[model samples]
Target: MPLNEEEAVLLGAAWQRLAGGGPEAAAVGAELLDRWNEPHRRYHTLLHLWETLRAVDVLQGEAADADGVRYAVWFHDAVYEGRPGRDEEESAELAARLLELVGEEPARIGEVVRLVGVTATHRPEEWDADGKVVSDADLSVLAGPTDEYLAYTAAIRAEYRHIPDRVFRAGRSRVLRSLLDGPHVFHTAFGRAHWEARARVNMLAELDRLASSAPLDLPPP
Candidate 1:
């Protein structure tokens, strides 16, 4: 179903707020593309946003508030300057303005903005189901089929193009290892059941490529 009027309004308001901040987030999909994804030529920019929303739709209660989800989408990558702290604060500030425009009750809007800040953590230890669902959606790209996974590897690498091959490889390997070594590849049953195993397979394949210095094909192993 197309997003209803309410959702469309809220989403547009949220996006407007993001654009007003002067980064032109919608132009090429937030800083995730320019600073990281573009630098690394990673495919996680708009495509990631699109797929995550699709996942959210299939999930029950997963939409929470389309506005809330929209807020998360804008702010999730808000903090991608290859540095930390700033993204969350900047996103929170933008959210504050958007909340004002949305005519959200001052208190509730503040709370929603804060939740957007929460996403800076990417994976919270404990949280509301809505936040978790959205977060899982953001990370779900990692859990896709092998070919999709390899594409992500390139995206991430493009983001870090300034780093030498050795440094980037080591760091990237560590990230993949951490995910692979984790007790759960995904936080929610939906993502775990649906995408975790394949994610692992793809991650391991990337790891192997790093270790062997071999050209990786789509989907690694």
Candidate 2:
């Protein structure tokens, strides 16, 4: 489903706050909402966009260019197709094109594109405050409560339902293990203090379940 009226109003306000209120900004925001509401998306839907934006708000003070990070959040998964690197790249491209149409400053647009690309790896240099904020916000879903985390995984699996069970399981395991191997699953101090441990627990639990299960037989959402 698309964002509800209140949610749409909030998102429009956010876009206008960054890009300014005008016909171009309105059109760009509407197009992005449509992209988020694309039928093929499962986990990477409007809900994820809203959650990531909220997380950015929580970590806003940590960013040198919080508006840039918010712009990145609006485009990070805008082109998600279950393909990792390519998706981020295309999303960044789309951000650049649309942001230009709305007359966003070139430097800010470049920063937004770079921030969107950071989500592909979820790794930013320790000194990159804006990048760190964007990465943390995009990954906050990993630290969700148990039921929400499981629902996230289910939605993800549903998104990639075309992949064979064994293939998907192996890929998902690698992704989880990489996160677990990191010193901290989240980049910001708030994330480390509040979300890191819970994210680890959630990922570890999912890893264990994936290890023991033959295949996830999830119903359509």
Q: Pick the candidate with the highest lDDT.
A: 2
User: Which lDDT tens digits does candidate 1 get at residues 7-126?
Assistant: 545544545554444434454234333332333224434455556656666653544565566555655554454544586677677667655654556765666676666555556455
In model 2, the clashing pairs are none
Model 1 bad stretches (over 4 Å): 1-44, 60-66, 215-221
Q: Global CA lDDT of candidate 1, please?
A: 0.60
Tell me the deviation in Å of residue 134 in model 1.
Answer: 1.5
In terms of lDDT, the poorest run of 10 residues in model 2 is 212-221
Q: What C-alpha root-mean-square deviation, in Å, does candidate 1 show against the real structure? A: 6.9
Model 2 score (lDDT): 0.91
Q: Give the TM-score of each candidate.
A: 0.69, 0.96
Local error of candidate 1 at residue 191 (angstroms): 1.2
Give the CA lDDT, 0 to 100, for residue 111 in model 1: 62
